[model samples]
Target chain A: MYTRTLFIDGQEDYPLTNRKEVARLAGVSEATVSRVLNGIGPMKDSTKKRVLDAAKQLNYELNAVASSFARGRSGNLGVVMPHVPKVHLFSTYYFSELLSGIGEAVRSKGYGLLLLFRDPAAEFDYVSLYRTQRVDACLILGASAIDSEIAGIHRLAEASLPFCVMDQRFEHSGLSIVAADHEQGSYDAVRHLIDGGCTRIGFLNGSPQYSNSQDRHEGYLRALAEAGIEPDESIFYEGNYSRTSGRRAAEAVYRDLGRLDAIFVGNDRMAIGLMQALREKGCRLPDDLKIVAYDDSDAASFTEPPLTTVKVPFYDMGRLAADKLLARLTDKDQTDGVINEKLQTELKIRKSSGN
Target chain B: MYTRTLFIDGQEDYPLTNRKEVARLAGVSEATVSRVLNGIGPMKDSTKKRVLDAAKQLNYELNAVASSFARGRSGNLGVVMPHVPKVHLFSTYYFSELLSGIGEAVRSKGYGLLLLFRDPAAEFDYVSLYRTQRVDACLILGASAIDSEIAGIHRLAEASLPFCVMDQRFEHSGLSIVAADHEQGSYDAVRHLIDGGCTRIGFLNGSPQYSNSQDRHEGYLRALAEAGIEPDESIFYEGNYSRTSGRRAAEAVYRDLGRLDAIFVGNDRMAIGLMQALREKGCRLPDDLKIVAYDDSDAASFTEPPLTTVKVPFYDMGRLAADKLLARLTDKDQTDGVINEKLQTELKIRKSSGN
Candidate 1:
């Protein structure tokens, strides 16, 4: 029967129960429980038994997930995700697959998952989860590579806490990251289009906050340069990797569809929308707008003319991040320095690529 | 009825190896499975084969009593979900929306989300969570209604703990439940189809574990009764609310499609797959067959004809469950027994309904 109705809207806020709850349940003073648990003060046998029983029943020792782990830990791994309204991040193929992978690996390791949604527009704090004993380590789903994000991780790096990022890469060295090689994926996609007798190939990428978008852009330019085709900014369109945004870009893309023979679109969702919009405008796929999409999601095959896209191992990436982080936590594998593991991306050729 | 787990960005209609899920998987009586496990009765080899396949699909161990590590003061709200292997549970629109809503409400109330995935085939032990103090209050996502679940929840109810379930219902009174009026949604969908001159309307529904499936089945029958149309078993198909299952059911559905003018599908994913398969078999959409699906997921609008689907407020249900549980935790609302609530569903008339 503890009551503190004052709700804190802090980004790093942890749940508020303390030893007070345990003390109340055990009918013992807070000092006695704390001293007994911490092994700092002496107590009578009867007092010890009462406190111990309550503590044991309450899992007050914080031993969870991995039974092998020592006491004084919550035994939970935190997954920090950005709560962007309307995006439906969790439903997306990239996120869903990665999360499934993470769940699989985490479950195997016997650790509980603590899901914390971060407000993108708010302040960032990574240490509070550790300080509050809410999670022993965390895996950040991502967000863009903005100043705040970089700064937040930078603070985390300084704190020297155990955590890693999935899919997104920050420039900071020695920061653990598990991601797909979008640069190589994009390069292959563009190169395939170029080799397929397409001269003026345009490109559509996503938000600049995701570091991989820049990699994709660079790959786009590299493929163009390698094929001796000059890069044109006029042919480039940006989308937030949403199908709606892809449809919206159809007007601009169609205006330049005359100049460009093919365009390498970002993810498959945007590709689906862009293709549908172009189809609505009487643009025959491949003939009017040959395209190569990224992230060969489930929707790829579901599209009218099935999309040819780069398949990123999102699930494996998720699993790898969790496996690495958990191993680090357990001191199982002591391989040093920024455990950077980049999985390969395969380009799945289908009807959309006219292959 | 859905024996297959489709790997296509997945899914719906499963909880795991409990008596309900096991019975569901085995297509045998739950009592039979229990007797077999408890060595209370004899069973045939075919029954044993069914259970083995389920274990193979899950790559999971048979039921084991979850060892309790009770202790606490983590100051968190535990969200209990079945960790169904090979099914991308989080990626499905239903789960993601519900979780997002839960996340939002929990965040606003300044409580941490402790996500615990129960191995579907494991023994139910909810009391351990509270006894361990991992969570002050918990919200169960769901599984089918089974005896062990009821017993576990019965113990919780006896414990007089404040908890609730989302989008699921049990027979016991005084259990807080927040769910969608699926019966209403199904009724509206079928009635609309019937009013549009569809006499021979087929139905594709999910598993029986989900009580809503029964509601939907009832709704389908009610609509038929109102229209003075005899309900035919041959016109009914079962899917796990998965796109792949939908496609698989297409063979059987299409065999009987000559008699049916329209069909009411269980969910959007199944509709997409069913439609795709039907189209592949040289059936024209809306003209040859009309469809009204459930769950207006993002993919609902992305289908070639854009599904005419019933939009269920999954996110709101998630929010309500979290909000109510948290409110109860804070003692802000002294509401009485069994706060049962259901939200409305809307039928979105897209081209697929031939409107």
Candidate 2:
């Protein structure tokens, strides 16, 4: 008997024998025993059963690291998210929807998801995950075009790791990116508001750190130019995409609510907050002011009078990102070129747009 | 020169050399090179810089599997959640808040989170994760006391794995659990409503499959009994803790809206939906009927009339659960017994309860 302490369920010790002893007891070669234990290859049912029975009788336990070493795969995909304290990424509709899509896609592919949060302020080594073999491939999310983030992308690119970026585009042409057509979505939203007879429209946009926000701003400008409406910089208030910021922006916009016939808010969350603040100030929807928002999240339909917004398929974007990475991981020949997939967005008409 | 193709960012081939070659170039022993690469032990700053610079110059990449095998640890924690297709767990405020808390705690500990979704209806092997050494410890979330889930818990318990359940308590006594004191929260919410001069109060609850719902039900009954008011089963409606279900529940409660003075809802999502439905039916909030909800989510304050509800600390619960599991993982001697922690909840008074 090879008696040694074994930790099971973090509790009591269990007696166990060595694999060699189990092999001897089962009347099989040690290599056969190893194969059966590791589920390495196809074997005769009788031989596998005999080996298993002997191992169980002797209480033989297989070491996890040895098996992983023999298998040559960690069987997990990595999702690296930007860690912002007090931001509550999971609670936000954008992250949650995108994560849902990633989870769904990863599960369907029979791969476990390894989530790692990287603080933008701290020094992070992205290649360490691949080098340490914790994750087979990684998907980067919520990455801005900051110096460190750009350097991290280049590091991964230099190392030749299998990875994808969700919603963020890099200057590197070879980087794999899955993003929504925010410009088109914004254009449609502004066009909808323009068609509704709004001449002087205010634009409440998110921070420029994100590529999507920039695209949305461009769309807003393009729509105004096409409509022959001069872009008013004073009415364009930048927000951080939070409901509180939206409420604050509403205050700024309210000072010039007389000149502004309608407003194009960046996302539905801010739009909802803006509506609440405007209502508290005695402004009625569609009667006094009309609004068009983006990102048709779950709250859009439930908002008072509902919100007319552009729907960004965050879930699909996540799924596509995961699928693309998985494909690269599985197909050796497929891992050679850049893949830039820009998914389509739809306009959902609701009561807030004066429809 | 030995040349071989390598995948970098799932793209074209990159030239790379082995660790041994880099070690030779750096004029250091291979053991020193390994130490510098794995970040296992402290080395002289000059030697560490030399090794890294040489590796970077030569483009040396470490093999992930061999390093993991040598380290004898996965450096990851497992979180198993119930899989409900199209349900979008991330979109739900409950799961998202909890995950945020878990993520924050896990990242602070310098541990990676490995997420796995198990189908409730299918047979799942929970022990494989630990047995295969994929994760150091596991945390089970959203698990009901279904036969399979209970069996999974027992399997983990039998194996003596370092694990904890979040929000769900099993029949087994020795299982570690971290959850909110929902019964007390419910009691507080109902008591607050009763103190507001509302005598006939209806109960809108979630499915009984979850233990929290049962506790909330008990609290509702207990509060009614203490107030000397008979509980009306006719006014009770069941929802799936969704805004849509809440809207549907409002229809059933509307028939007796004349008789009911107030209603206690299971969560803020349902309460928001129920209020929308009631408003559409021309019912004045706090004038025709007052409402008290559970889970003071972000949307709770933004809802029309603003919900007065029981504040369930989901983020704190997640953080506490992660902390407990991490403690068990790090402390070998502390894993002998079960730890069941029930966190306290707070009541947030707002406009919806006529406060």
Candidate 3:
């Protein structure tokens, strides 16, 4: 008889036999069974068959979600992102990293992620998950400049639903926010460009609609003012935060090329686009033009010239946000100062910026 | 008197109200107010304010979910994906397209999505959702060659949790499945590659442990057999269907560069990665290394040499899965189908393969 121990929710449940049990029955290890599972590990194919045959005789239930729920937790999380559907394709790499961070955080917390794309066009309500109680709490990703999202969170608070916002710099009286210090990060990026001896700089701004975009623009101006260089309004161009927009902005700059020697791109996607445009125009990076982009996405590192960009602490943000939400949920009268956590961004100097 | 029309659980309740009765609300149409309440059309900022102020003054309660629930519908459909913790950068595109499909499908049905991730290390039971009454039905994604998922679904079936699987070529009894015809798609890719005058072709396969991967691999062999070429063992490599693995596999192929003149990558991510690697080595695309990839994600068109890939009916898969689950949920006895839906794949030829 094969016997294996398995956790059902938090309690032990006995099943007929799993590969682990088969391994136990054969006086081997689970790793040996894993080899059979993948058909790659060092176990002979014949031994793998014996383990499988032993397991076939004993039926085992391997549904983790059901077992976890039995332990008094659904092992599920409610993740709310701005229901802006158009933003995904243009900015996948950024959100991909964010998802990776949140996924890692949730897994550590012994929970699985349940994505809730709050349709911006629809009523901003968390009731779909809240009323049914599918998740323990919510993590709101990129909740910046969207007033309705804040309003929705306020409603959640009234309903006693716990949630924490990520990457949004807001000083609301009772809101919990975890974010990267974009102003300081932007300040550092511009300072690096200025120190590299590029006086005439262009700011490729994202649409000033988003609060984070506004902060980055403000940071750019602050850096210029601190350096005693008058802010150049003529060099600033506001566009959508996309590679296509980045390419267009770079082309716009190139049409009047001599006026600007360096450009600060809003995001890495746009930054890569801008660099591609510059390269197509036969402009040598760092020699002819200096580039500094924000958001060190996977594409940023793999760009033709490795990008010089600011890295946001997505992992830290996710963990801290989860912690904050959990804290607020447990403590009823714990409302005081807004739990605003600012993670510092690192300036990664690479070939594009002559670093 | 303030008059308001409240729709609760599909039952209309009208409370009579005058503009002065709700407080001296200025210059807002009742239609605009209704639109905002129903989450219908956009309203001017000032108009939105006047209506909200009036509603607040009248002490009107907004119950979005309750109304939907009153109709004996939860207005939520569950989405289940394999609990792979790592973020596939391209999943941003995959998810967006899928949600768009589901969104359109359920828009008329008045349902929202309940996205859940299954932990690969954890069990796969979905009975908790049923116990909590969170969603009506589930759409399972990425259940590849693993027969355990089928057994899990059978358990869910026993528990009366409706579910439908996508992208896998499984025809389990008493289950509904939506999948792309990868066998024919792979045949098309190989035929195209052969037509391009490539005799020695390399295959960047996905984890062969999967049923879909096995089907695609079999298709490749079938195509080779049809072409009267001996299916060489040395030209195949298995990898996780990601860009990084694609690049690594390309590098492996580059080490034995002259043996193969073309490559067929399992997914778009891998195809893009392989293209980048080949480009880095100054290998001319199509002219030197013709390529064909699968899953025409957004990045496919944006690759250096735009990818020539197969477009899976991703949106249709999502929709069909939703429909099947909904059918089962509406009436259990009505869900009698070995619904083996094989959606067609479109061959998108672009600059990468010199199309």
TM-score, one value per model: 0.80, 0.85, 0.73
| Residues A10-117 of candidate 3: C-alpha lDDT, one tens digit per residue | 333333135467677656676565334322213443675666676455543222222222322334577766545434321366565566566655545444466655
DockQ of each: 0.12, 0.26, 0.07
Error of 3 at A296 (Å): 2.0
Error at A157, model 2, angstroms: 2.2
Query: What 10-residue stretch in candidate 3 chain A is worst by lDDT?
Result: A1-10
Query: Residues B176-290, candidate 1, lDDT per residue (tens digit)?
Result: 8899999999999999999899999999998778899999999999999998999989888899888889999999988997899999999988999999999999999999999
- Tell me which of candidates 1 and 3 scores higher on TM-score: 1
Question: Candidate 2 on A317-339: residue-level lDDT in tens?
Answer: 99988988888877989888676
Reported per model, the fraction of native interface contacts reproduced equals 0.24, 0.45, 0.06
- Per-residue CA lDDT of model 3 for B274-323, tens digit only, reads 77777778888778888899888766765667789988877777777676
* Model 1 misplaced stretches (Cα beyond 4 Å): A1-70, A332-337, B1-73, B332-337
For residues A175-247, write the lDDT of model 1, one tens digit per residue: 8888888999999999999889998888889898898899899888899999888898889999998888899
lDDT of candidate 2 over B196-246, digit per residue (tens): 888899999998888989999999999999999999898899998988899
Best by TM-score: 2
Ranking by lDDT: 2, 1, 3
Interface RMSD (Cα, Å) for model 2: 11.9
